[model samples]
Each structure stands twice: as C-alpha cells, then as structure tokens.
Target: MDHMGADPDPDGRTAREQLKSERERDARRRRARRRFSVVGAVVVVAAVIGTVFALGGAAEDEAEGRPLVVPANTVGEQRTSVLYGKADARHTLSVVVDPRCAPCARMEAALGRAMRQLADKGAYRIEYRLATVEDDARGGKGSRWAVNALGAAANEGPEKFVRYLDAVLAGRSGREEWDGDALASPETLLGIAGRVDGLRTPAFDKAVRELTYLPWAKKVAAAHNQNGDEDALPAVTLDGSTVTVLGDDGVPVSPGEFIRQVRGDKG
Candidate 1:
C-alpha cells in the first residue's frame, strides 16, 4: 500500500524502530538460551565436585607412602563396597546412600529388617555404596566420618559391617536433622559401634579415630557416581536396574512391595 507496507508490524512504529525492536527481542532470546545451557553445564559440574569433596577428596587421601586398601570382605573387582549375603546370591541389590541424608536413614530404618532377612535367605547380596555429599552440602565431616566408620566395620567382617550399618543408619532415622558437627566427633561413631556386638575393638577404635579406610571410602563414593543418578541417596538397584523402593516424598513402600520390586514385580 504505502510503498513500505504500513510499518511492517502494524504497531505504528517507524520501520527503523520496528527493526530495532525485533533485534532486541532476538538478543533477549539468545541470552535466555545461553542461560539454559550454562545451567545444564553447571548442574553436571556441581555433581562431580560434590561427590569428590564429600569423601575428603579435596584433601590428600593417599599421602606419599600411604597405599589404597580394600576392606576385608568387600566384593567386586574394584572391591569398593561392604557386601552382605552369599557371594553367589541370585540377585545383587546395590544401595547408594549418604550418612547424613534423612531420607536414606528413613529408608534403612523402614526396610532394613526385610533387607537382612532376604540377604540371609540368599535371595540377594546387598552392596552398600556410601556417599559423602552431605559433608559438602552441610559443611562438615560427619558424612566422611560415618563412611570411615563403616569402612572399619567392614574390615572387622561383613557381618559386623552390616550390623553396624543397621544400627547406625536405622538409629538416625526420624531425627530432625543431622548434627554434622556432633557426628564429626569420633565418639559418635564409637558410641554407635558399641551397640554392635564385637564391633568395638582397639583396631576399630584406631581406624575410626584415624580414618584408616578414608581412601577406600573415597573410592566407594566415587564408584557410586558411575551409576549416573547424581548419587541420589537411598536409591536401590537390582542387578543394575533401579527399583523404586521409596515414594516421591521419601517414604518407603511396604516391606512386601519393596521385596517384590527387588524380585522384579513392578505391578
């Protein structure tokens, strides 16, 4: 109509003004895309960093002559876990957890007995992969300390290790919050170990106090990251497949259902 078509967008702006507005809109969109990309990248990087430092990886774990040691009864080629059940159990149930995660403690409390019974029956071998993300998130060494305690417990024996885990993690459930500072004290773990018969010995006391298995704990924490769920605590997998043992709100399902899920019944 009027040579340049009535200001292009019909907003009454001049052609030049309309062009400038479109340019600005495009720039805003570009910035939004950049922000989304940065956010995605940040999430991945944060997970890696969190896992590393959670187990005291930020500090030197293996100093000059300090060698990496695996716990006595740990399984797998990497030997990064405390194993429960027969070595040739029909199924392998791997649990990824953090000592300070309330949900993790809750899950263990709710289903711990059932888990042990199954392991006793040779239904599955429970591989507990401990993570230390809480130490990084909460700004203390409690998670690392707890993991170290478990490592020492495993060295005593898998039975003792499993007993210690059942006692400590199960006991921590329903607490309002984890006292990282309090747990950082060696006495906390030592106190809990006292409940597990034969768990408290001079060797275990020395290991708990000096973090004898800290490097092994670090490796176990790192090994869990390979699962690629960002080390979400209280997560369970059966023979390498994830099982939904807990609801979205962190409440575990009925013990029967948990067993069924592990047995491959989703319905």
Candidate 2:
C-alpha cells in the first residue's frame, strides 16, 4: 500500500507530458530560425535596390555638371547659320539675310563697318543667317550661286567669310545687272574671294563651282522662313526677341542706328 505514490503514474503519463513539452520547444525554435532567415533575405534585397538607385543618381549628377552644347542641326559644316558670339556675352544680335534682297544689301552696306567695330569691341555677338527667299522664288536660279559661295567662304574662316560678305555687299551697289547672269557667277565670286587675302583657295573655288553648299544654303533659308513672318526678309532679333529699330526722331532708323541701339548707345 505504501507504493501508491511511486506507482500513481506507472502508465508513463509524466514522461509523455515532458516529451510533449520538448517537442513544442523544438517547434518554436524552428519557427524563430525561419523568421530570422526571412528578415535577413529582406535586408539583403533592400541593400541591393539601394545600391542600384545610388549608382543611377550619380550618373545623372555627372551629366548635369557638363557644359551645355548646341545641337548639331543648328550648326553647319562651316558653322553657317550658327550663332556667333562670346560665350559670356550679355546680348545676341541675329541677322537673317538673303543674298539677293536689296534691303539686306542696303543694310549690310550701311552697317557693315559699325557692326564690325562693335563686334571687335565685344559690344555684342553677331550671328549671320543666310536665306534664298528671292532666288528660290525666281526658279532657284537667282541667288543660289551667291548663297553657296558664301557658305564656301565660311568654310575657310569666319574672318574670311566676313571679308567676302563685305565685298559682296559692296559690289551690289549701282550694279543693277546683279540679278540673273551676275549673281555669284564663277568668275564674279572667285574674283570677290580673291580680293580677300587667303580666301581664294582651290578647295573654296571647287566648292563654289560645284554648288557643294547649295543644300545647306537651302536649309538655312528654310530655318529663316520658319523662324519669322514670311514678309520679314531681313528679320533681326535681339536675344531671340524681335525688335524694331527707331531713331531719335521717332522714325525707323537706318542700319547704323540699329547697331547703336543694339549697343545700348542709342534709343
């Protein structure tokens, strides 16, 4: 009868209870290990994504630090129709002209010297845009030759181009015969180029004779047409805004007054 306490669980109930508790503990540990593994995987994925974004951001920053470059379409082989000026200049003077336009010729004649002087003084940067408005209208035979010749001259150097332009405009005066047979003829243009020192190269001659730059001339004209009203042959813009030239007398000013106005020396 005293063996009652020792034999109370002779069926092994206490041992079974201890075994169940051990199994439950093992299950909890397994679940904890799985949770740690999931958390570690999530952290690794987040780090990878962060690294990718950081690299992308650095590339964008590098691009932003570079200097601005003009688009190629806006520039020609010899920088024809391209904006010309000091990079830090405060004002931009853009002149769109046609070789055969009488008004353009007159403007060039009147303002050529002043424009050159102002350009040399760094008063404002000047850009020349060529167009064939009259020539193209006259069956593409009027000023195409002259326009192409200008492009060829530009290929040599900007100085040479300016000299050649001055010569061309100077020739236009009192030459009522400048229309059909005389506009930049092979002999005429080469003669003009010859006057400018170092501009009458054999390559330049070949380009002019072969109309090598006619296509580019057409493009420049098209650009001019698209940028301004159709009737505005000699479209002039200051810093991309169209402006009118007026004299102190309240009348439309001549080219010289226009230059002075652009220089801020005249109203």
Candidate 2 lDDT trough over 10 residues, lowest sum: 68-77
Model 2 per-residue lDDT tens digits across residues 85-190:
4535676677777776666666666666666676667767778887777755655344656777887887777677777877776665545436553664567788
lDDT (10s digit) by residue, model 1, range 79-168: 887788898887888888887787888888888889889989898888888888877777877777788789999999988987888777
* Top lDDT prediction, candidate number: 1
lDDT of each: 0.79, 0.66
Q: For model 1, which pairs clash? A: none
The top-ranked prediction according to TM-score is: 1
Task: Give candidate 2's error at residue 4 in angstroms.
Answer: 99
